[model samples]
Target: ISIIYISSNHIAAASEQLSTTSQQVSQGASEQASSSEEISASMEQMVANIQNNTESAKQAEAIAFKSVEGIRKGYDSTTYALNSMKKIAEKVSIIGDIAFQTNILALNAAVEAARAGEHGKGFAVVAAEVRKLAERSRLAAEEIDRITHDGVKIADEAGRLLSEIVPEIEKTARLVQEIAAASMEQNAGADQINSAIQQLNQITQQNVAASEEMASGAEELNSQAQQLIDIVSFFNIGERETLKTLSNLRNDTRKIAQKTTTPNTEFWKSKRTKSKPKPAEGIDIKLSSNSDDTNYERF
Candidate 1:
């Protein structure tokens, strides 16, 4: 019985400990589940941001492509305009040469008219007017040539700048495309991480459920152990009562035996006293009934 009691106590203690540990585990699992859910939510948000970044990168790439196209077209147009300016400048130079030749011819004609006399007076006035017109034309042609040359120079410089810009724009477009590709890859990675996190969250939820089950089982075990302890306590009380009753019975039997034997001892003493010989008070008594008896013996 003592062994049983000790065993019950140990089992109860172990059950209580197990219940406590199980409760702790359940609580921890619940916390972990909550944390995992939060992490999963954060991962989802990160994935969304990554996706947005990917889309933005794609849009930037498209804009870069469009810019490259526009730059290319502008460069081509500038080249064409530069060529046109060169042609215009050449034509203006030719016009200036023609004007100079006309002025020289007009001057010679004027000198020849002056050599003629009064009949050449009218011709001399006409030659002077022609020379003046030729001089004006030459001046105007020179001015036009100068303006065309300046225009050509400006066009050439613009074309050169456009040529430089086109390559840089192309480089920018390429870089933007790479950025878009990287963003897409990063977005994909984020999605995968989010998925993993979701799976982890699910596992954590399972753990929480399992832990709760374990805790419940532990609690049930603890309750059973408590009932067993109660049963053991009842048995212990019964065993103690049995021992006490046996001790009391033994004591009562001993007392009864003592009470019953005490009267027997007194009755035997009275019988011996009644059987004892009485002695006369004034006579001297001598006992010689047997040779071995020399003196009277006390009963």
Candidate 2:
């Protein structure tokens, strides 16, 4: 009887402590669920922002590609212009050579006319004028050749600079493409993480609900333990028949000590939280049926 009383008392106290711990676990689970939900929302927003940034990077990459194409065309045009200027300079040099040949022929004619004396003196003046015209033509051709050469140099430099720019723009485009790809990958990773967090939050909520139900079960168990302590006094060490009868009635309890059992109208209610917990489903706490046992045979 003393052992039964001690075990019953310990069970009841442990049940109460279990109920308190379960409530704390439920509350902590609820907070964890709420926090998980908030983190999921924030992660969703971050994914959206990353999508926007990825789109922006794609646009920039496209623009860079266009710039590269445009520069490539310009470079080709500059190279063509440089080649054309070089050809023009060559033609001008040819014209200068022709003028020099004409001047040399005119000088030879003047010398021959001088050798012919009085008859060739009239042709001397014409030869001298021819030489002068040829010299002036050679000077004009030289000036044109110099201008064309300078133009060729400028065009070549432009082509070279444009070639440099093309590589740079192409490099920039590649970098932008890489950035866009990385952002998309990051968005995918974030989406997967957010999904996992959502699942975890759901599991946490279920755990919180289970913990609440467990607390209710522990509360009911505590009530039954206290009631079992009530009937322990009937245990005896007398005649075998009487002891057998008591053994047959072993551990059976009545709904006695109603005054001592403080009924919790809102058993799951907490001062910190106003939310009402759902009923403890699947935990059957059977109470003694209301009946007046008039005969001693029932005892």
* lDDT of the candidates, in the order given: 0.76, 0.81
lDDT of 1 by residue, 13-115 (tens): 8877887888888889889888888888888888888888888888988998898899889888988988988888788788878888887888888788888
Q: Compared with the true structure, what per-residue lDDT tens digits does model 2 show for residues 1-299?
A: 54455578889999999999999999999899999999999999998999999899999999999999999999989999998998899899999999999999999999999999999998999999999999999999999998998898899889989988998999999999999999999989999998999899989989999999999999999999978776643343234444444443452223223323644543223312434443652222222344333322323
Candidate 1 error regions (>4 Å)? 237-299
Off by over 4 Å in 2: 1-8, 98-136, 164-168, 216-299
lDDT of 2 at 90: 88
Q: Over all chains combined, what TM-score does candidate 2 have?
A: 0.61
Model 2 per-residue lDDT at 203: 95
